[model samples]
Target: MKLQQLLSHTRKAVDEYQMIQEGDHIAVGISGGKDSLTLLYALHGLKRFYPNHFELSAITVDLGYEQCDFTPIKELCREMEIPYHIVKTDIAQILFEERKEKNPCSLCAKMRKGALNQAVKEIGCNKIAYAHHKDDIIETMILSLFFEGRFYSFSPKTYLDRMDLTVIRPIMFVDEADVIGFKNKYNLPVVKSACPVDGYTKRQYAKDLLADLNRQYPGIKQRMFTAILNGNIPGWPERIPYIR
Candidate 1:
C-alpha cells in the first residue's frame, strides 16, 4: 500500500471517531512491528496536513531483550523529525526467568503498557496511538467468544480517567496484508521481535482459526468486521460512510 492510500484509510477512521482535535499531541506506541510502523508513518504524514493540526512523538518500551535492537527505529524517527523515547525494563527477565509464568503474554503486556503509559504522561502527551488493525479487531472478537463466552472487541477510541489519557487507533481501517505491503514498499525499519512466544500465543491460534474460516466462507471476515461496526457494543463508535 502506498502512503496516500494509507492516509485515506486513516483519515476515515479519525473522522468517524473524532479522534483528533486542534493542537492535540499524540504519542505513537512503536512495537517495531509492521502494524505499529505503518501507524507511525500514517500519523506522521497526517500531522503535516490534517485539519486538526496535531503534534506527534514516537515511543517504544523495550522488554529487556538482548537481540532486539531499536537503532533502525531511532533512525526512522530522526528522519521523520518526531521525538522518540525507548523505556527499558526488566520485563522479559521477570516473566521468563523469575516468575516463569506459563501464560506470560498477560503479565508482559500489563508491564509494557504501564511503562508506555507512564512514559507518555511524562512526555506530556494527552493521547496515545496504537496500531491495531482490522485483522486484530476480527481476531479479538473471535478470541473473546471462544475463550470468554462473549462478543467483545476494543473500541477505536478510549479514555482512561485515571491517567487523563485518550487512546486513539487511527489505522484501525487498514488490513494486516496492507501493513505487510506498506512495510515492504516503504522499507520500514522493522525490528524483529525476540520474545520466546512471539507466534505461539492464543492470539495466534485465533488468527489461524479466522483465516481457516475465511477460506471456508469467503467474505466472512468482512462480515465479522461489519458486525463489529454495527454491533452496538459498548465503546465501539458508529461506522463511517467512507469505510463502506
Candidate 2:
C-alpha cells in the first residue's frame, strides 16, 4: 500500500477523534518501535495539509537502562524536522530489581504513562497521542475480559479531568502488521528494549495467547478488533459509582 494512502486513512481517524485542532500542540509518546515511528511519519505527512492547524513533538521516556542512549531517535527526529524530547527515569531498575512482581506490566505502564503525562504538561501540550494500534486494542480488551471480568478498552480520544488535556490514539484503526510494513518501507531506525525480561511479561502472554487463538480460528483477530470498536467499551468511567 502507498504510504500516502495509509496516511490519508489515518488522517481521517485524527479528524474523527478531533485528536488535533486549530493551534493545537500535540506531544507524541515514542518508544522507538515501529508503531511510534509510523505515527511520527503519518503526522509528518498529514500536518502539511490537515485542515486544522497543529504541531507534533516526539517525546521518549528512557528507563535509564545501562548504556541506553536515544541519540539515534533524536537524529531521526532531526531528519524528520520534528522536535524531540527524552525524559530519562530509572524504569529499568524499578522494573527489574525494585517492586518487580511476577506480573508487573500494569504497574510499569502506569508509572511510565504518568511520567509521560507530566512531561507533556511541562511542555505545554494540549493533547498527547500514543501509537497503540488495532492489535493493542484487541489484546487489551481480551485481557480485561479474561482476567478482570470487565469490558474495558482505552478510548481513541479521552480527556483528563485534572489536567484538562486530550489523549488520543491516531493509529487505533490501523493494524500492527501494517505498522511494521510502514516502518520497513520507511527504513526507520528502531531501538529494541534492552531489558533482560523484555516481552516476557503477562502482556506478552496475552499477545501469544491471542496468536494461538487466531491460528485455531482464522479471522478471529478481526472479530476481536471489531468487538472492541463496536461493542461495549467502558468509557466515561468517571461517571460510575464507587463500591466498597
The prediction achieving the highest lDDT against the true structure is 1
What range of 10 consecutive residues in model 2 has the weakest lDDT sum? 235-244
In candidate 1, how many Å is residue 79 off?
Answer: 0.7
State each model's C-alpha RMSD to the native.
1.3, 5.7
* Quality of model 1 by C-alpha lDDT: 0.93
Q: What are the lDDT scores of the predictions, listed in order?
A: 0.93, 0.81
Residue 153 of model 2: what lDDT?
80
Which residue window of length 10 is worst by lDDT in model 1? 235-244
- Estimated TM-score per prediction? 0.97, 0.90
What's the true lDDT of residue 24 in model 1?
Answer: 91
**Candidate 2 clashing pairs?**
none
Per-residue lDDT for 1-244 in model 2, tens only? 4588667667767765567779989998998878888888888888888878888899998877766667788998899888999998987787778876666666778889888999999998989989988888888888888889988888888999888888988887787778878877878788887767678876688889888999999999999887766675656222222121
Deviation of model 2 at 91, angstroms: 2.3
